[model samples]
Target: MRTSANPIIADLRDRIQHLEGSVARHKAILPFGVPEIDAHLPGGGLAYGALHEFAGGGVGTVDGAAAALFAAGIAARTKGKVVWCLARPDLFAPALAQVGLHPDRVIYVEAIREEFVLESFEEALRFGGLGAVVGEVVRLPMKASRRLQLAAEGSGTIGLMIRRWRRPTEVGDFGHPTAAATRWRISVLPSEPLPVPGIGRARWLAELIRVKAGESADFVVGACDVQGRISLSSDTADGSGETRRSVHSG
Candidate 1:
Protein backbone atom coordinates (compact mmCIF):
# COMPACT_ATOMS: atom_id res chain seq x y z
CA MET A 1 0.00 0.00 0.00
CA ARG A 2 1.15 3.55 -0.81
CA THR A 3 1.21 6.11 2.00
CA SER A 4 1.44 9.92 1.78
CA ALA A 5 4.50 11.70 3.20
CA ASN A 6 3.89 13.23 6.60
CA PRO A 7 3.26 16.98 6.30
CA ILE A 8 5.53 17.79 9.21
CA ILE A 9 8.37 15.74 7.75
CA ALA A 10 7.90 17.37 4.36
CA ASP A 11 8.08 20.84 5.87
CA LEU A 12 11.17 19.92 7.89
CA ARG A 13 12.88 18.56 4.81
CA ASP A 14 12.17 21.75 2.89
CA ARG A 15 13.63 23.85 5.66
CA ILE A 16 16.71 21.67 5.82
CA GLN A 17 17.26 21.99 2.11
CA HIS A 18 16.95 25.76 2.28
CA LEU A 19 19.48 25.92 5.07
CA GLU A 20 21.91 23.77 3.15
CA GLY A 21 21.63 25.97 0.08
CA SER A 22 22.21 29.08 2.16
CA VAL A 23 25.30 27.60 3.76
CA ALA A 24 26.73 26.60 0.41
CA ARG A 25 26.17 30.04 -1.00
CA HIS A 26 27.84 31.66 1.97
CA LYS A 27 30.87 29.43 1.64
CA ALA A 28 31.14 29.68 -2.14
CA ILE A 29 34.35 30.64 -3.89
CA LEU A 30 34.70 31.22 -7.60
CA PRO A 31 37.96 29.63 -8.67
CA PHE A 32 39.75 30.51 -11.86
CA GLY A 33 40.60 26.78 -12.06
CA VAL A 34 44.21 27.70 -12.67
CA PRO A 35 46.45 26.35 -9.97
CA GLU A 36 49.06 29.03 -10.39
CA ILE A 37 46.53 31.78 -9.73
CA ASP A 38 44.33 29.92 -7.28
CA ALA A 39 47.30 28.92 -5.14
CA HIS A 40 48.04 32.56 -4.43
CA LEU A 41 44.49 33.64 -3.65
CA PRO A 42 42.90 33.20 -0.27
CA GLY A 43 40.55 30.20 -0.11
CA GLY A 44 42.03 29.21 -3.45
CA GLY A 45 39.74 31.61 -5.31
CA LEU A 46 37.65 34.77 -5.07
CA ALA A 47 35.28 34.79 -2.16
CA TYR A 48 31.63 34.98 -3.19
CA GLY A 49 30.61 37.68 -0.76
CA ALA A 50 33.28 40.23 -1.52
CA LEU A 51 34.08 43.24 -3.68
CA HIS A 52 37.04 43.23 -6.09
CA GLU A 53 38.40 46.02 -8.25
CA PHE A 54 40.03 46.01 -11.68
CA ALA A 55 41.76 48.71 -13.68
CA GLY A 56 43.62 49.07 -16.92
CA GLY A 57 47.34 49.69 -16.78
CA GLY A 58 46.95 52.66 -19.09
CA VAL A 59 44.22 55.17 -19.92
CA GLY A 60 43.99 53.92 -23.49
CA THR A 61 40.95 52.12 -24.89
CA VAL A 62 42.82 48.88 -25.56
CA ASP A 63 43.92 48.45 -21.96
CA GLY A 64 40.46 49.40 -20.76
CA ALA A 65 38.95 46.76 -23.03
CA ALA A 66 41.35 44.17 -21.66
CA ALA A 67 40.30 45.00 -18.12
CA ALA A 68 36.63 44.71 -19.09
CA LEU A 69 37.19 41.37 -20.80
CA PHE A 70 39.01 40.11 -17.72
CA ALA A 71 36.03 41.00 -15.57
CA ALA A 72 33.61 39.55 -18.13
CA GLY A 73 35.47 36.25 -18.12
CA ILE A 74 35.24 36.06 -14.36
CA ALA A 75 31.53 36.85 -14.48
CA ALA A 76 30.99 34.18 -17.13
CA ARG A 77 32.29 31.50 -14.78
CA THR A 78 29.70 32.40 -12.17
CA LYS A 79 26.14 31.08 -12.05
CA GLY A 80 22.91 33.08 -12.51
CA LYS A 81 22.50 36.38 -14.31
CA VAL A 82 25.03 39.22 -14.22
CA VAL A 83 24.09 42.85 -13.64
CA TRP A 84 26.42 45.37 -15.32
CA CYS A 85 25.99 49.04 -14.43
CA LEU A 86 27.95 51.54 -16.43
CA ALA A 87 27.83 55.24 -17.20
CA ARG A 88 29.12 54.74 -20.73
CA PRO A 89 27.10 53.10 -23.49
CA ASP A 90 30.11 51.72 -25.31
CA LEU A 91 30.08 48.17 -23.97
CA PHE A 92 30.71 45.77 -26.83
CA ALA A 93 28.45 42.77 -26.40
CA PRO A 94 30.19 40.85 -29.15
CA ALA A 95 33.57 41.24 -27.48
CA LEU A 96 32.13 40.14 -24.17
CA ALA A 97 30.71 37.06 -25.85
CA GLN A 98 34.06 36.35 -27.39
CA VAL A 99 35.48 36.29 -23.88
CA GLY A 100 32.68 33.90 -22.82
CA LEU A 101 30.11 36.25 -21.22
CA HIS A 102 27.12 35.98 -23.52
CA PRO A 103 24.76 38.93 -23.84
CA ASP A 104 21.84 36.78 -22.75
CA ARG A 105 23.31 36.26 -19.28
CA VAL A 106 23.70 39.97 -18.61
CA ILE A 107 21.29 42.75 -17.63
CA TYR A 108 22.78 46.02 -18.85
CA VAL A 109 21.91 49.20 -16.94
CA GLU A 110 23.07 52.43 -18.50
CA ALA A 111 23.16 55.19 -15.94
CA ILE A 112 23.72 58.86 -16.69
CA ARG A 113 26.49 59.25 -14.12
CA GLU A 114 28.90 57.24 -12.02
CA GLU A 115 26.88 57.87 -8.90
CA PHE A 116 23.82 56.40 -10.55
CA VAL A 117 25.85 53.46 -11.73
CA LEU A 118 27.05 52.85 -8.19
CA GLU A 119 23.45 53.04 -6.96
CA SER A 120 22.37 50.36 -9.41
CA PHE A 121 25.39 48.26 -8.60
CA GLU A 122 24.67 48.35 -4.89
CA GLU A 123 21.03 47.43 -5.41
CA ALA A 124 21.94 44.44 -7.57
CA LEU A 125 24.49 43.26 -5.07
CA ARG A 126 21.99 43.46 -2.26
CA PHE A 127 19.30 41.65 -4.25
CA GLY A 128 21.56 38.53 -4.23
CA GLY A 129 19.60 36.76 -6.95
CA LEU A 130 22.07 37.66 -9.64
CA GLY A 131 25.33 35.79 -10.18
CA ALA A 132 27.43 38.93 -10.10
CA VAL A 133 27.27 42.73 -10.06
CA VAL A 134 29.67 44.92 -12.07
CA GLY A 135 30.06 48.67 -12.02
CA GLU A 136 32.35 50.92 -14.04
CA VAL A 137 33.43 54.10 -12.36
CA VAL A 138 36.30 56.53 -12.64
CA ARG A 139 36.79 56.64 -8.90
CA LEU A 140 35.49 54.75 -5.89
CA PRO A 141 35.51 56.72 -2.70
CA MET A 142 36.05 54.79 0.51
CA LYS A 143 32.56 55.57 1.79
CA ALA A 144 30.84 54.40 -1.39
CA SER A 145 33.01 51.31 -1.54
CA ARG A 146 32.16 50.39 2.03
CA ARG A 147 28.45 50.45 1.25
CA LEU A 148 28.91 48.18 -1.75
CA GLN A 149 31.13 45.84 0.24
CA LEU A 150 28.59 45.51 3.02
CA ALA A 151 25.80 44.83 0.57
CA ALA A 152 27.79 42.11 -1.17
CA GLU A 153 28.76 40.48 2.13
CA GLY A 154 25.18 40.43 3.27
CA SER A 155 23.86 38.94 0.05
CA GLY A 156 26.79 36.61 -0.70
CA THR A 157 27.05 38.02 -4.21
CA ILE A 158 30.36 39.04 -5.78
CA GLY A 159 30.90 42.64 -6.88
CA LEU A 160 33.32 43.76 -9.59
CA MET A 161 34.27 47.41 -9.87
CA ILE A 162 36.09 48.49 -13.00
CA ARG A 163 38.03 51.74 -12.80
CA ARG A 164 37.98 53.45 -16.15
CA TRP A 165 39.89 56.65 -16.73
CA ARG A 166 40.04 59.06 -19.67
CA ARG A 167 43.31 60.81 -18.87
CA PRO A 168 46.72 59.53 -17.80
CA THR A 169 46.69 61.74 -14.74
CA GLU A 170 43.45 60.11 -13.62
CA VAL A 171 45.30 56.81 -13.32
CA GLY A 172 46.71 58.06 -10.04
CA ASP A 173 43.29 57.63 -8.46
CA PHE A 174 43.70 53.84 -8.39
CA GLY A 175 46.41 54.24 -5.77
CA HIS A 176 43.82 55.43 -3.29
CA PRO A 177 42.58 52.91 -0.75
CA THR A 178 39.12 51.40 -0.74
CA ALA A 179 37.20 48.42 0.64
CA ALA A 180 37.89 46.10 -2.26
CA ALA A 181 39.08 42.64 -1.29
CA THR A 182 41.51 42.70 -4.16
CA ARG A 183 42.71 45.10 -6.85
CA TRP A 184 44.02 44.05 -10.23
CA ARG A 185 45.45 45.75 -13.27
CA ILE A 186 45.31 44.28 -16.76
CA SER A 187 47.46 45.34 -19.68
CA VAL A 188 47.39 44.08 -23.24
CA LEU A 189 50.41 42.00 -24.21
CA PRO A 190 51.63 40.32 -27.36
CA SER A 191 49.94 37.09 -28.28
CA GLU A 192 51.73 33.81 -27.85
CA PRO A 193 53.84 32.54 -30.73
CA LEU A 194 51.89 30.44 -33.21
CA PRO A 195 53.01 27.33 -34.99
CA VAL A 196 52.19 28.96 -38.31
CA PRO A 197 52.30 32.53 -39.59
CA GLY A 198 48.96 33.60 -38.15
CA ILE A 199 47.69 35.46 -35.12
CA GLY A 200 47.49 33.49 -31.92
CA ARG A 201 45.51 33.87 -28.72
CA ALA A 202 45.67 37.22 -26.97
CA ARG A 203 47.65 37.62 -23.76
CA TRP A 204 47.71 40.04 -20.84
CA LEU A 205 50.04 41.11 -18.12
CA ALA A 206 47.79 40.54 -15.15
CA GLU A 207 49.03 42.32 -12.05
CA LEU A 208 47.57 41.50 -8.70
CA ILE A 209 48.05 44.98 -7.33
CA ARG A 210 46.58 44.09 -3.99
CA VAL A 211 44.91 41.13 -2.31
CA LYS A 212 43.47 40.80 1.14
CA ALA A 213 46.10 39.18 3.40
CA GLY A 214 48.31 38.24 0.49
CA GLU A 215 51.32 39.64 -1.35
CA SER A 216 51.05 41.17 -4.78
CA ALA A 217 52.10 39.22 -7.88
CA ASP A 218 51.95 39.36 -11.64
CA PHE A 219 51.34 36.71 -14.27
CA VAL A 220 51.39 36.57 -18.02
CA VAL A 221 48.15 34.84 -18.89
CA GLY A 222 46.44 33.82 -22.07
CA ALA A 223 43.26 35.67 -22.86
CA CYS A 224 39.99 34.15 -21.75
CA ASP A 225 38.81 31.44 -24.10
CA VAL A 226 35.34 30.86 -25.56
CA GLN A 227 34.37 29.19 -22.30
CA GLY A 228 35.69 32.15 -20.31
CA ARG A 229 38.60 30.16 -18.96
CA ILE A 230 42.05 31.75 -18.54
CA SER A 231 45.30 29.86 -18.35
CA LEU A 232 48.79 30.69 -17.17
CA SER A 233 51.40 31.24 -19.83
CA SER A 234 53.69 28.36 -20.70
CA ASP A 235 56.39 30.00 -18.62
CA THR A 236 54.28 29.83 -15.50
CA ALA A 237 52.67 26.45 -16.31
CA ASP A 238 55.92 24.52 -16.50
CA GLY A 239 55.76 23.73 -12.76
CA SER A 240 58.75 25.85 -11.83
CA GLY A 241 56.65 27.33 -9.06
CA GLU A 242 57.51 30.89 -9.97
CA THR A 243 55.43 34.08 -10.07
CA ARG A 244 56.61 37.66 -10.48
CA ARG A 245 56.41 39.29 -7.10
CA SER A 246 55.93 42.95 -6.18
CA VAL A 247 55.36 44.82 -2.94
CA HIS A 248 51.96 46.48 -2.80
CA SER A 249 48.83 46.62 -0.66
CA GLY A 250 45.16 47.52 -0.93
Candidate 2:
Protein backbone atom coordinates (compact mmCIF):
# COMPACT_ATOMS: atom_id res chain seq x y z
CA MET A 1 0.00 0.00 0.00
CA ARG A 2 1.22 3.54 -0.85
CA THR A 3 1.97 5.73 2.19
CA SER A 4 -0.19 8.83 1.32
CA ALA A 5 -2.93 7.21 -0.80
CA ASN A 6 -5.65 6.51 1.74
CA PRO A 7 -8.95 7.63 0.14
CA ILE A 8 -10.62 8.49 3.47
CA ILE A 9 -7.79 10.79 4.59
CA ALA A 10 -7.63 12.49 1.18
CA ASP A 11 -11.40 13.14 1.18
CA LEU A 12 -11.23 14.62 4.67
CA ARG A 13 -8.40 16.95 3.65
CA ASP A 14 -10.31 18.20 0.60
CA ARG A 15 -13.45 18.85 2.61
CA ILE A 16 -11.54 20.83 5.22
CA GLN A 17 -9.86 22.95 2.55
CA HIS A 18 -13.22 23.73 0.93
CA LEU A 19 -14.72 24.75 4.24
CA GLU A 20 -11.78 26.99 5.03
CA GLY A 21 -12.02 28.76 1.68
CA SER A 22 -15.72 29.35 2.09
CA VAL A 23 -15.19 30.84 5.53
CA ALA A 24 -12.47 33.13 4.23
CA ARG A 25 -14.70 34.46 1.51
CA HIS A 26 -17.56 35.13 3.86
CA LYS A 27 -15.47 36.64 6.65
CA ALA A 28 -14.12 39.65 4.72
CA ILE A 29 -17.21 41.77 5.16
CA LEU A 30 -17.86 45.46 5.84
CA PRO A 31 -20.62 45.52 8.39
CA PHE A 32 -23.50 48.00 8.41
CA GLY A 33 -22.52 48.50 12.08
CA VAL A 34 -26.21 48.38 12.99
CA PRO A 35 -26.94 45.50 15.29
CA GLU A 36 -30.41 44.83 13.99
CA ILE A 37 -29.36 44.50 10.37
CA ASP A 38 -26.02 42.84 11.14
CA ALA A 39 -27.82 40.06 12.96
CA HIS A 40 -29.51 39.09 9.69
CA LEU A 41 -26.34 38.81 7.65
CA PRO A 42 -24.32 35.61 8.03
CA GLY A 43 -20.97 37.30 8.54
CA GLY A 44 -22.43 40.30 10.32
CA GLY A 45 -21.92 42.61 7.30
CA LEU A 46 -21.85 43.07 3.53
CA ALA A 47 -19.30 40.78 1.92
CA TYR A 48 -16.29 42.26 0.21
CA GLY A 49 -15.27 40.86 -3.19
CA ALA A 50 -18.90 40.17 -3.97
CA LEU A 51 -21.65 41.88 -5.95
CA HIS A 52 -24.81 43.29 -4.35
CA GLU A 53 -27.85 44.55 -6.21
CA PHE A 54 -30.38 47.26 -5.32
CA ALA A 55 -33.33 48.75 -7.15
CA GLY A 56 -36.33 50.99 -6.68
CA GLY A 57 -39.84 49.62 -6.31
CA GLY A 58 -41.00 51.32 -9.46
CA VAL A 59 -40.22 53.84 -12.15
CA GLY A 60 -41.63 57.43 -12.20
CA THR A 61 -41.44 57.21 -8.42
CA VAL A 62 -38.53 58.83 -6.58
CA ASP A 63 -37.78 55.52 -4.89
CA GLY A 64 -35.09 54.92 -7.51
CA ALA A 65 -33.14 57.80 -6.08
CA ALA A 66 -33.51 56.29 -2.66
CA ALA A 67 -32.07 53.01 -3.91
CA ALA A 68 -29.09 54.75 -5.46
CA LEU A 69 -28.32 56.58 -2.23
CA PHE A 70 -28.45 53.38 -0.24
CA ALA A 71 -25.89 51.82 -2.53
CA ALA A 72 -23.75 54.95 -2.36
CA GLY A 73 -23.80 54.92 1.42
CA ILE A 74 -22.50 51.35 1.36
CA ALA A 75 -19.81 52.28 -1.12
CA ALA A 76 -18.71 55.19 1.06
CA ARG A 77 -17.65 52.75 3.75
CA THR A 78 -14.88 51.40 1.54
CA LYS A 79 -11.37 52.71 2.14
CA GLY A 80 -10.20 53.87 -1.32
CA LYS A 81 -11.60 55.62 -4.33
CA VAL A 82 -15.04 54.56 -5.59
CA VAL A 83 -15.72 53.99 -9.27
CA TRP A 84 -19.23 55.04 -10.28
CA CYS A 85 -20.00 53.70 -13.75
CA LEU A 86 -23.06 55.67 -14.65
CA ALA A 87 -24.86 56.38 -17.93
CA ARG A 88 -26.43 59.70 -17.06
CA PRO A 89 -25.08 63.10 -16.11
CA ASP A 90 -27.74 63.88 -13.54
CA LEU A 91 -26.08 62.45 -10.43
CA PHE A 92 -26.01 65.10 -7.69
CA ALA A 93 -22.67 65.18 -5.89
CA PRO A 94 -23.97 67.11 -2.88
CA ALA A 95 -26.74 64.56 -2.45
CA LEU A 96 -24.16 61.76 -2.47
CA ALA A 97 -22.15 63.56 0.20
CA GLN A 98 -25.22 63.61 2.37
CA VAL A 99 -25.20 59.78 2.32
CA GLY A 100 -21.44 59.49 2.98
CA LEU A 101 -19.98 59.21 -0.56
CA HIS A 102 -17.79 62.26 -1.01
CA PRO A 103 -17.22 64.10 -4.31
CA ASP A 104 -13.46 63.87 -4.12
CA ARG A 105 -13.37 60.12 -3.57
CA VAL A 106 -15.66 59.34 -6.53
CA ILE A 107 -14.28 58.37 -9.93
CA TYR A 108 -17.19 58.72 -12.31
CA VAL A 109 -17.25 56.90 -15.66
CA GLU A 110 -19.96 58.25 -17.86
CA ALA A 111 -21.00 55.49 -20.22
CA ILE A 112 -23.63 56.21 -22.82
CA ARG A 113 -24.73 52.61 -23.26
CA GLU A 114 -25.66 49.82 -20.88
CA GLU A 115 -22.95 47.57 -22.27
CA PHE A 116 -20.41 50.29 -21.75
CA VAL A 117 -21.51 50.72 -18.18
CA LEU A 118 -21.09 47.02 -17.45
CA GLU A 119 -17.71 46.93 -19.12
CA SER A 120 -16.49 49.88 -17.13
CA PHE A 121 -17.77 48.36 -13.92
CA GLU A 122 -16.03 45.04 -14.51
CA GLU A 123 -12.79 46.78 -15.41
CA ALA A 124 -12.94 48.91 -12.31
CA LEU A 125 -13.63 45.93 -10.12
CA ARG A 126 -10.61 44.13 -11.52
CA PHE A 127 -8.41 47.02 -10.51
CA GLY A 128 -6.51 45.85 -7.45
CA GLY A 129 -6.59 48.85 -5.13
CA LEU A 130 -10.02 50.46 -5.43
CA GLY A 131 -12.24 50.66 -2.37
CA ALA A 132 -15.45 49.83 -4.21
CA VAL A 133 -17.22 49.91 -7.58
CA VAL A 134 -20.78 50.93 -8.44
CA GLY A 135 -22.58 50.67 -11.77
CA GLU A 136 -26.01 51.83 -12.95
CA VAL A 137 -27.97 49.60 -15.26
CA VAL A 138 -31.60 48.76 -15.71
CA ARG A 139 -31.01 45.07 -16.38
CA LEU A 140 -28.05 42.90 -15.55
CA PRO A 141 -27.72 39.67 -17.58
CA MET A 142 -26.47 36.52 -15.90
CA LYS A 143 -23.31 36.27 -18.01
CA ALA A 144 -22.17 39.82 -17.34
CA SER A 145 -22.98 39.44 -13.67
CA ARG A 146 -20.79 36.37 -13.36
CA ARG A 147 -17.89 38.27 -14.89
CA LEU A 148 -18.38 41.15 -12.47
CA GLN A 149 -18.45 38.77 -9.53
CA LEU A 150 -15.20 37.18 -10.64
CA ALA A 151 -13.55 40.56 -11.06
CA ALA A 152 -14.52 41.56 -7.55
CA GLU A 153 -13.16 38.32 -6.21
CA GLY A 154 -9.87 38.85 -8.00
CA SER A 155 -9.49 42.44 -6.77
CA GLY A 156 -11.18 42.28 -3.38
CA THR A 157 -13.41 45.30 -4.18
CA ILE A 158 -17.01 45.48 -3.13
CA GLY A 159 -19.44 45.80 -6.05
CA LEU A 160 -22.77 47.63 -5.89
CA MET A 161 -25.27 47.43 -8.75
CA ILE A 162 -27.94 50.15 -8.77
CA ARG A 163 -30.78 49.44 -11.18
CA ARG A 164 -32.39 52.30 -13.12
CA TRP A 165 -35.16 51.49 -15.53
CA ARG A 166 -36.66 53.83 -18.08
CA ARG A 167 -39.96 51.98 -17.88
CA PRO A 168 -41.69 51.04 -14.64
CA THR A 169 -42.36 47.49 -15.80
CA GLU A 170 -38.69 46.79 -16.28
CA VAL A 171 -38.23 46.80 -12.51
CA GLY A 172 -39.40 43.22 -12.52
CA ASP A 173 -36.22 42.18 -14.26
CA PHE A 174 -34.29 42.77 -11.06
CA GLY A 175 -35.52 39.47 -9.67
CA HIS A 176 -33.59 37.47 -12.21
CA PRO A 177 -30.43 35.78 -11.01
CA THR A 178 -27.20 37.71 -11.43
CA ALA A 179 -24.79 35.76 -9.24
CA ALA A 180 -24.88 38.60 -6.74
CA ALA A 181 -24.30 37.89 -3.08
CA THR A 182 -27.30 39.89 -1.93
CA ARG A 183 -30.22 41.77 -3.47
CA TRP A 184 -32.05 44.76 -1.98
CA ARG A 185 -35.10 46.79 -2.85
CA ILE A 186 -35.53 50.31 -1.53
CA SER A 187 -38.80 52.21 -1.32
CA VAL A 188 -39.34 55.72 -0.05
CA LEU A 189 -41.35 56.01 3.12
CA PRO A 190 -42.99 59.10 4.55
CA SER A 191 -40.67 61.02 6.80
CA GLU A 192 -41.08 60.72 10.55
CA PRO A 193 -43.89 62.75 12.10
CA LEU A 194 -42.15 65.01 14.53
CA PRO A 195 -43.33 66.34 17.91
CA VAL A 196 -44.30 69.48 16.07
CA PRO A 197 -45.84 69.71 12.57
CA GLY A 198 -42.53 69.96 10.70
CA ILE A 199 -40.90 67.26 8.53
CA GLY A 200 -38.66 64.73 10.27
CA ARG A 201 -35.79 62.64 8.94
CA ALA A 202 -36.33 60.44 5.89
CA ARG A 203 -37.16 56.79 6.37
CA TRP A 204 -36.98 53.85 3.94
CA LEU A 205 -38.30 50.35 3.58
CA ALA A 206 -35.12 48.40 2.90
CA GLU A 207 -35.69 44.85 1.79
CA LEU A 208 -33.10 42.11 1.52
CA ILE A 209 -34.75 40.16 -1.25
CA ARG A 210 -32.00 37.59 -1.78
CA VAL A 211 -28.98 36.23 0.01
CA LYS A 212 -26.37 33.74 -1.16
CA ALA A 213 -26.02 32.58 2.43
CA GLY A 214 -28.18 33.07 5.54
CA GLU A 215 -31.87 33.95 5.55
CA SER A 216 -33.24 36.96 3.64
CA ALA A 217 -34.92 39.78 5.53
CA ASP A 218 -36.10 43.40 5.45
CA PHE A 219 -35.79 46.55 7.51
CA VAL A 220 -37.45 49.95 7.95
CA VAL A 221 -34.32 52.00 8.42
CA GLY A 222 -33.72 55.69 8.80
CA ALA A 223 -30.61 56.56 6.74
CA CYS A 224 -26.89 56.36 6.60
CA ASP A 225 -24.82 58.20 9.16
CA VAL A 226 -21.74 60.01 7.86
CA GLN A 227 -19.21 57.96 5.84
CA GLY A 228 -21.88 55.57 4.54
CA ARG A 229 -22.82 53.97 7.83
CA ILE A 230 -26.49 52.94 8.24
CA SER A 231 -28.63 53.59 11.32
CA LEU A 232 -31.65 51.30 11.45
CA SER A 233 -35.02 52.32 12.89
CA SER A 234 -36.79 49.93 15.22
CA ASP A 235 -40.31 51.03 14.35
CA THR A 236 -41.67 51.95 10.94
CA ALA A 237 -43.43 54.92 12.47
CA ASP A 238 -42.55 58.61 13.07
CA GLY A 239 -39.06 60.25 12.85
CA SER A 240 -35.55 59.84 14.16
CA GLY A 241 -33.72 62.91 12.77
CA GLU A 242 -31.54 60.66 10.63
CA THR A 243 -30.72 60.76 6.89
CA ARG A 244 -30.19 64.53 7.15
CA ARG A 245 -29.95 67.13 4.40
CA SER A 246 -31.30 65.16 1.42
CA VAL A 247 -34.57 63.29 1.50
CA HIS A 248 -33.52 61.54 -1.72
CA SER A 249 -30.60 60.04 0.18
CA GLY A 250 -32.77 57.88 2.42
Q: Assess candidate 1 and give its TM-score to the true structure.
A: 0.87
* lDDT values for all models: 0.90, 0.82
Off by over 4 Å in 1: 1-25, 235-241, 248-250
Q: Which 10-residue span in candidate 2 carries the lowest summed lDDT?
A: 241-250
User: Per-residue lDDT of 83-188 in model 1, one digit per residue for the tens?
Assistant: 9999999999999999889999999999998999999999999999789999999999999999999898879999999999978888999999999998999999
| Every candidate's CA RMSD | 7.1, 6.2
Question: RMSD in angstroms, candidate 2?
Answer: 6.2
Instruction: Please give each candidate's TM-score.
Output: 0.87, 0.84
lDDT per residue for candidate 2 within 141-220, as digits (tens), equals: 99999999988887778999999988867978986788898888898888756779987778888888777756666677
